[model samples]
Target chain A: MSTATFPEETRARLEVDAKEIIGRYPRQRSALLPLLHLVQSEEGFVSAKGIAFCADQLGLTTAEVTAVATFYTMYKRRPTGDFHVGVCTNTLCAVMGGDEIFAALKDHLGVGNDETTEDGRVSLEHIECNAACDFAPVVMVNWEFFDNQTPESAKRLVDDLRLGRDVAPTRGPDRLCTWKEASRVLAGFSDGRGAEGTQAGEPSLTGLRLARERGWTAPDPDRLPVGDDPEGGAA
Target chain B: MSTGTTLTPVLSDNWDRPESFTLEGYRATGGYGALRTALGMEPDALVDLVKASGLRGRGGAGFPTGMKWGFLPKDNPNPRYLVVNADESEPGTCKDIPLLLANPHALVEGVAIASYAIRSSQAFIYVRGEVLHVIRRVRHAVEEAYAAGLLGKDVLGSGFDLDVVVHAGAGAYICGEETALLDSLEGYRGQPRLKPPFPAVAGLYASPTVVNNVESIASVPSIVANGAEWFTAMGTEKSAGFGFFSLSGHVTRPGQYEAPLGITLRELLDMAGGIRAGHRLKFWTPGGSSTPIFTDEHLDTPLDFESVGAAGSMLGTRALQIFDETTCVVRAAGRWIQFYAHESCGKCTPCREGNFWMVQVLDRIEHGEGTEADLDKLLDICDNLLGRSFCALGDGAASPVMSSIKYFRQEYIDHVERGGCPFDHAKSTVWGGTA
Candidate 1:
């Protein structure tokens, strides 16, 4: 671990937040995950100083904090860029052009997977499924959905980020937040944009829309007859 | 033969509304009515109602939800806990995230109602960290519930105390496993704990805990508002009630289709405008990638617990990832193996090492650099992982690898003969024909 610690003012401010996090659980050790997020928000990645801060606050050793941090993919071992651009190269997304998009972004940004650009504007990684499979070939910049992406569109997305242009996600908040700002939200702090954007995307509403279009509604619960299969066909 | 009559929209009914995520928006649609109803009834009666409703867990394992809650020992003095598994990371399983994004209060209300049933005062929702917006929505909903006096001590002045905490999980697929989720919540490496006590006996600080899926818990409120018979009336005799059938990949209109269990994919595909333009279904997963893959022949298989099991695959999270003729099974299986191998917790040797070896073997075969013996070698690794790993992660890892070979052995042979994947990757992508 690095001998350096957070400067006095930063340490004092973080300790107050750490107190609130530790209080959420019955035991202080249970706060490690969120504390790690808090530190990542402070520094771009979980630095050695950050681990010491978490360990000191949570009453655990730095070794314990490092072990927990290393096990999870989200905790960055080193510095991260302003935007963490992840291409969903999982099976469904890969088959639907995620592989091509990842390759295109790598070429366009002059970076390999998990590597940040020279200007520190973007870090690229091939992420597992972020659970938006209906919008296939998805990309996430700092964990915001950039759904239904093409190779060209993904390239343009990174260029806009690197160039510091305004970028909006397909579904969530109207404007994308920095990676650090997003991590703070994950640490249980609100950015106040929770209800800012379209709550449901089109693909998320396919069944409901179709049912409404066909005027289909569930059968009245009170009208159902008794003596139906109670065990529900267990035999 | 399935028509609009087969559809039942309980959880997804209000998702289309722009204001569905807000407390006011949800209240306008009769939100929290079930929790109020549940508060007036005896807790045991609520449990009995769930048992009578035949509501099974929607998170891959189809264990009866009420049965799981009943597993809590009456003699245990430790504070019981309720954990909602919101870590929806299964490849192609996309329903819970959307549900929370559009309507998080349903889950919050379910948490309060189920907490009372299990007699637990505190509940925690472990959402995956990748979805920052979903975390915000859930957190905002909890804050709103507290402001409205719908949560916290003596909720709604009914003498039922409840507190909800929304916890975010760092990226780990194995944490979706209930035991691992508990471990992760307690600030440990998310490795699956061995069962004996299970989570019901000793979980989350060695306390008696009831863990349920997001969908399973969210279904509780509706079951409370409607009687058990209403739930049983919608679906088949066994797999009663409705679930989100998430259709992804090359389908013409891919999305979440909430229909009763046991609806045939053949009928759902008909509703989804069949496979894109001219393509026909080649193979698909009955659930997520973890379930064994199925081909066009199994399209008529009823998507329920027993029927899919009888057909040699589990109806996992109902994530029906469809693929058409242009996709290569070998490449698809390879990518899934890579996912499992990457996500393996390394707690069990069979899954950790077996997945590592399988990845190399599948890669060699996919690259057309291996002999035909590689197929048997791939199956051998799966055999070791299926029943031998510490948790279901290993079994899930072995699924697509074994099933793809079983259905498309000739495709593996084609990759071998052609010296690489035979299918052109360009034709299967969304932007394929346009450019």
Candidate 2:
């Protein structure tokens, strides 16, 4: 029944950004998700104030805004860590040592799933498939990839983060920022740093490289292969 | 081991080129040529070309792509829309993410052509939130396309104004469903809506819409560039044209193997260097984990939709997750069930409750705590979940449970008989301790 409010300066800044996001959609209510991201960009978690702010911008009740916020797993209800470390434990990744990485990190970092460390540095959790199965046993830091990771390497990666050492994603932009900065970028505000990272990995290009090497292609009408369908003239 | 199937690189042809994600790189490779040709033709004619090409949806369900576009009513005064489902969350399915990351312009160009064919000015690409790098690449591609006059008002001086919005979803698997995606786009919880007025009738602000998969849309430019006969020349009769079969797990070389529809896993395994080093293939999915598991006996089975279905599995997403002999089938199936349980969305009781119950039983069985009745109980729960649930998510949850038990019921019994998993836990575990 109670709702918190943001500070005046933060509220004014979000209002300007909210208007731009709302303008992107024909209906104001549709801006709810991005607006939640915008608020999370300002505050690490989706606070009560953040929910109230989204409701105000989208002209919806707090309950409706809260429903959408709680539905998605990405929006943090509590304060998240400076570095959100997620190990993929989906079927492929788990079989490829993701389960091991997850269990190791839990003991190594002294935090369970979705729990941030006491130092407020790293929050570790088991994420679903990130669609990067080519780089199996993937570990993501602040939503950037640390691909083909081993448990030892992942342990060191988190330690480096907590110690304030510079860490880099295996396949991401040259620069690595905190989780908050990534959230801001997701809020539709361009940071002028786009497409400046590694594009594709070796695993992604394996099939393409093999195809070019063998000179193989879709069956050409002029020069079909020897085992062409007997009934086929052309498809 | 070779089945002699040639690798056909349709969508991934230019992926190796540097800056393939850039507009210049795309244009250099004859990227937007199809858009230029398609813009000059009647939109209906372009639709007919796709229909004649026998292009089917590549986002798990093998529905006809052109027929999906034709479902949009023409008389509606309200603006129609095109939503590209880039939320590639199906386990072991990795093609769309890499495709967008390596060559986003292909999809941007596809979006333009698709929107033009559907007579819509606005479109959206809904990408999953976890892959920030992919989202950034897609956003940059859209910006570059707009700056090049390939998007926005009067594209390429063809008088077809279009706008593309790249939206990011915040970690929910159910949003990959087309209806749930539309609902997520409309700023609601990503839950499937009731049918009767499907997405074609009312979607994304109550306007007629066509939701196509990322691969399905990206395949369009090539189809338009080449003739329908050219597109149809590669794949089978019903399932025509090439698709990306993502081969992952214990393979010596795992990646997206682009081939024609009817290519068998045996040939693909040969291309991928065959199941790690010396280990033999134990079980695999023709698609993602949502489909039933296939053993080495079915290695020669053609992977087209019809053939895969005939062999008792839907070609859902063409994600071939290969597991080797060292893997425990019961443990693997348990992990997949945990995924379904974690992502059930809790909208329908069958999916939500059935997944939770299945996870409990599967975990107990894997940990040497289950009795024989648990096996029957697992199947009974699967029976309740399949077909009785709201969406395919329920059926998908039941697939690995039922199929794994069908093939590897002995392994489940062994876990109980031996009082533990026979396979070394360290081989699969990171810390090498017991579960």
The most accurate candidate by lDDT is 1
Interface C-alpha RMSD, model 1:
1.1
Give the distance in Å from residue A212's predicted Cα in candidate 1 to where it truly belongs. Answer: 0.6
The complex in candidate 1 yields a DockQ of 0.82
Please write out the lDDT profile of model 1 over residues A18-69, one tens digit for every residue. Answer: 9999889987788999999999999989999999999899788899989999
Per-residue lDDT tens digits for candidate 2, residues B342-382, read 89888889889988998899889898999889999999999
TM-score of chain B of each: 0.98, 0.97
Worst 10-residue lDDT window for candidate 2 chain B reads B426-435
Clashes of each: 1, 1
lDDT of 1 at B301: 86
